[model samples]
Target: MLPDTLDITAIRADFPILSREVNGHPFVYLDSGATSQKPRQVLDAERAFVENFTSAVHRGAHTVAGEATELFEDARARIARFVGVGADEIVWTSNATEGINLIAYGMSNASLGRGGQAAERFRLGAGDEIVVTEAEHHANLVPWQELAARTGATLRVIGLEDDGRLRLDEAAAIIGPRTKVVAFAHVSNVLGTVNPVSSLVDLAHAAGALVVLDACQSAPHLALNLGALDVDFAVFSGHKMLGPTGVGVLYGRAELLNALPPFLTGGSMITTVTLTETEYLPAPARFEAGTQRVSQAIGLAAAVDYLDAVGLGAIEAHEEALGGRLLDGLGAIPGVRVLGPTHGAERVGLASFVVDGIHSHDVGQFLDDRGIAVRVGHHCAQPVHRRFGVTATTRISTYLYNTADEVDAAVQAVADSRAFFGVDR
Candidate 1:
C-alpha cells in the first residue's frame, strides 16, 4: 500500500499553531477544504524573501533584482514540476478565482477579435455553448455565466446523479456540436467527490471543445498531471495547499496560452510599446500584469518542496482512510445526512453534511465550543446544495497533518450537537 505511514508527530510539529489551545481545549482544525494551515518552513520562506531579496522582478538591472527574478522563475519551475507541467505553463494569479476569470475574459477578448487569426479558435458567438457541471464552485460557475452573457454563447449544465456524481450519460448528450468549451471541477469542493476527469475529457474532446478544470480541491491532496489529463486550462490556489494567500496558479497548454488574448494589459507583459500600439510577451507574462506576488511565490515553492518530501502517494492514501472514517462516523449519527459518495467510493478526506432540525451555523457553533473548527455554509457551491435540496451544510475537511483522533473528536461533537439542540432521532 502506502510507502510507510507518515510520521504524524513530526508533521504536527511542523505546524506551530497545532500546539495552541482554543476554548480551553486543544485546537482541532478540520476546515482544510476552505484553507489549509501553513507550516513553519513555508512561513520562513516568505519571510526570508521579504527580508533579504526584496526587489522588483524583471524590471531592475541591479544585483538584488536579478536574484529576485531568478528565484521567482525558479519557483515557477519547481511548481511546474510538482504538477507535471513546464514552467511556461504556470501563470500566477491572485487566487484560483482570478485564474478562471483571466481565461474567461481572455476568451471574451478573443471573441471580440482581439488576437487576430491565431486566436480564432477561442472565439465564441451565438449557437456556441459553454458547459459546466452542477457541482462547480461559484468561482467557476459565475465566470462562465459572465462569459456567456458577454459572447452571446449559451451556458449549458451537466446534471448530477442523486449521489452527487456527474451524470456521464447525460454529459455525452450535453457536450455536442455547439459546445465550444467544457469546464468542470476536478474534484468538487463541497461534496469532496472526485469527478471522472478522463471520461469528461473524452466527451469534450470528441465534441471539439476546450476543457477547463477547476483543480482547487484536487491540487492540495492528489498527485496531479494536467498534461496527462489533457485539459487546456487548470487552476488551483496556494492557500488550500499549505502556502500563503494572494497567490494561485493557472496552467494552460503552451500553444493555446500563446494564442489566447491577454486579459490584463500593462508593464512587464509587453515587449514593445508605442503611443498607438503594444506587443505583449508570451504565456505567463502576458497574463501577469502589474506587481507580481514574489514573496508568496517563494512560499508556495517551499510548500511544493514540503509536499514532495512527504510524498503525495502517502498523503493520498492517508486522506482516503480519513475520508472513510468521516463517512462512517457521520453517517451513523441520528438526523445527520452526509453528502457526496457513500463509503467504499473514492473521495478526498472531506465530508459535508446537514443536521435535521438544526441549522448549519448552530452546528458550527456547537463544534467550535469544543475547540473543533469546521466550515459551515454553502461553501461557495450553492448549485451543489440546490441539487441536494439543502440551503447549507457543515463540512469537515482534513489534510496531511490531520490525525484520526481529531476526526473522531469532531464526529462526536456533531453527534452531541443534535442532543444539545433537542433534535430527536
Candidate 2:
C-alpha cells in the first residue's frame, strides 16, 4: 500500500507536464518505459548545478572545477547508496546500452589479449558459450552477438515459454562448463514479467559463468540490491528512472571491475599517459572517459533522492496495483491479447497487447487520436516479440506519478481504439 507520507496529489503537482493536454484532450502519458518525465525537483537540481557550478569535473585546479568534481562524486555516492553498492562499483556511461557494450567490448579486448593476465577470465574461444535470453533488448543482445562474432564464441539463448517468460529450465542443460557469461533482463519491458534474478544468478554462478543483469526495467520500479543479488554486473539508464538523458550506470562487483578491462580510454580516465603507452585509473574513473555528465549526474542523484523519499516499497506496491488493474482491465476488453503473464503472476507496471485484425501502428494511432501516448513496436526486444508471433505490440508503461484512474483511462482508450479502427470483435 502507498504510504500516507506520500501525497499523490502533491507528487503529481511536482511534475509540471502532467497537466498537459494532447490533441485538445487530457494527456495520458504512458511511454515511461521509453523515458520518464522529470519532476520539478530534478529539473531544479540540474538547473542549480548548471547555473552555479558549470565547470568540467576533475579537469582543472579552479574553484568551480573543485565544486563540480565534488558534486559529481557526491552524486556517485548517492547513486551507489540507492543501488546498494560502493562508490567504486558504479561506472558512469552515456546510458545502460553503453554500459552493457562496455562489458562486451572489454571482454572482446580481453579475448584479443588487452588487459593481460587479469582479463583472461573474460576470454572466450570458439567452444565457449555466451548465454542470453530471448527477452533481452537489442542493446543487450547485439553487443554480445558482436562479441561472439569477434571472438568466435557461440551465442546461446534461453528461449521463452508460451506465456512469454524465459525458459530457465534450459539453464542447467545449456549453461555448462564452457559458458562464460549469462546476460538477461531483470524485468521484461514489453511483457512486464519480472524475471527470477536470484535463481538465474545461482545457475550462472554454479556453472562458473558471470551473471549480467539488464536492470533497465527493474531498477526504477523495484528495490535493487545489486550486491545482495550477487550478479557480476548490472546496468540501468537514468532516463528510465526519472533522471536525465545522456547519463546511465554500470554496477559491477569491485573485484570483477578491477579484473575487467576498460572499454573507453583517454583524458580523465587515465592515471598516466606516455607517447607509447597509457595507464588507466581504477574502475569508476577508468570507465568514465572524456568529460563526464556532471549536471545530469546531479539530476540523477536528485531522482534517487525523489524515489528514496517516496520509498521503494510503496512505489512497488503502487506499480503492482496499477499493473494488476491494467492486466485485468485489458484482458477483459474484447479482441485484446496481452502478451505476458495474465493471471496471479507479479509483473512491473507495463502492459503490451495487440488488437485482433489490426496493425499495431493503427492501434497506436487510434490511441493517439484519443490523446493517449503509447509505445508501439517490437520495443527493442524483437526476439521476444518474435517468440510471441507478433511483429509489434502497443505498450502502455507507468511510473510513480501514474494512478489507477490513469490506468483505467488508458485501458478505455485502448478498448475504444479497436472500435475506431474497425477491429472490434
Candidate 3:
C-alpha cells in the first residue's frame, strides 16, 4: 500500500520531455524499459558539474580537481547507500552490458593464468557449468556464453514454463555439483516478470556457485537491497533509472570484488606504474580503469536522491496500478496476446504483446502516428521471444510519470493499429 496523496500529476510535470508533441499529438511515452526520461534534477546536476566544477579527478593537485574528486567519491557513497552496499564495492561501468562483460572477462583472465589466487576463484574451466535462464536479456546471456566458449565450460539454461515464468523445478535439477556461476535477471525487461531471487540465490549457494543479478529493470522500479539479497554481484544501467546515459553501477560483495582481478587496466587504476611492473589499486578503482564518466556519476547520484524523495515504495505502487490498468485495457482488445504472465500480480509496468495478423513493426509505426511511443522488437531477449513463439513483440512499458489515461490511449492506439491493418473487427 502507498500514501493516498502520491501526486502523480505533479510528478509528471517534472519531466520536460513529456510535454513535447509527436505527429500532431501529445507524446505518450510507454517505452520506459528501453530508457527512462530524465528529470530536471538529474539534468541540472550534470549541467552544474560542467559549469561550476569541471576537472580531472583522482590525478590532480589543483583546487578544482580536488573538489571534483570529492564530489565524485561522494556520489559513489550516495549510490552505495541507495543499494545497501559499502562504498568500496560499487564500480562505475559504461552500462550494464559492460558490467556483465567485466565479470566474464575477469573470469576469462583467471582461467588463462593471468590473475593470481583471488581471481582463480572466479575462473571457469573444463567441465564447469554456468547456469542461466531462457528469460535472460542478452546482456546476461551472451557474456556467460562467451565465457563458456573461452573456458571450455558448458553453459546450461533454465527453461521457461508454459506461462513464461521461470521453471524453478527444472532449475533445481540443472544447478548441480559442477555449476560454478548462476546469472539471471531480477526482473524480465520484456515480460515484466519479477523473479524469485531469494529462492534462486539460496539454490545457487547450496550448489557452491556464485550468483550475479541483472538488476537493470528492477533497480529503477523496485526497492533493492543487495546486502539482504546476498548476491555476489549485480549490475544496472543509469539511463533506465532517470539518470544520464553512459553510466552504470556494478555492486559486488566487498570480499568478492577484492578477490577478483581488474577487468580493464591502464591509467589511474594502478598503485605504482613502471614499464615492466605495476600493481593495481583496490577493488572499485582497480575495476574502473582509464577516464571515468565523472559528470554522469554525479547526475546519477542526483537521480537517486530524486527517487528517494518521491519514495520508491510509492513509485512501485503507482506503477503497479498503471500496470493493472494497461493490462486490462490491452486484454479488452481483440487479437492481442501478451507474451508474459497475463496477470499483473507478479509483474511490473512493462508488457510485451503480439497482434494476430500484423507485424510488430507495423504495429509500432501505427502507434507512432498516434503519438504513442512503444518498443517494437525482441527487446533484446530473443530466447524469451522464441519461448513465446514470436520473433518480436510490441512492448508498452510505464514509469512514475505515466497515467491511467495514457494507458487507455496506448490501448486505443493499438486497437486502431489492428483495424488500420484490417486484422481485427
Which candidate number maximizes lDDT?
A: 1
lDDT at 154, model 2: 98
* TM-score per model over all chains: 0.99, 0.98, 0.98
The sequence of per-residue lDDT tens digits that candidate 1 reaches over residues 1-425 is 32347988899999999999999999999999999999999999999999999999999999999999999999999999999999999999989999999999999999999999999989999999999999999999999999999999999999988888889999988999899999999999888889999999999999999999999999999999999999999999999999999999999999999999999899889999999999999988999989999999999999999999999989999998888888889989978998888876668999999999999999999999999999999999998998999999999999998888999999999999988999974
| Clashing residue pairs found in predicted model 1 | none
Q: Which digits, one per residue and each the tens of the lDDT, describe model 3 over residues 355-420?
A: 999999999999999899999999988999998899999999999888888988999889888778
Ranking by TM-score: 1, 3, 2
Candidates 1 and 2, the one with greater lDDT = 1
Which ten contiguous residues of candidate 1 have the minimum total lDDT?
1-10
lDDT of each: 0.94, 0.89, 0.91
Candidate 3 overall Cα lDDT vs. reference? 0.91
Q: Rank the candidates by lDDT, best first.
A: 1, 3, 2
Model 3 clash pairs are none
Please report the TM-score between candidate 2 and the true structure. Answer: 0.98
> Which regions in candidate 1 have their CA more than 4 angstroms from the true location?
1-4
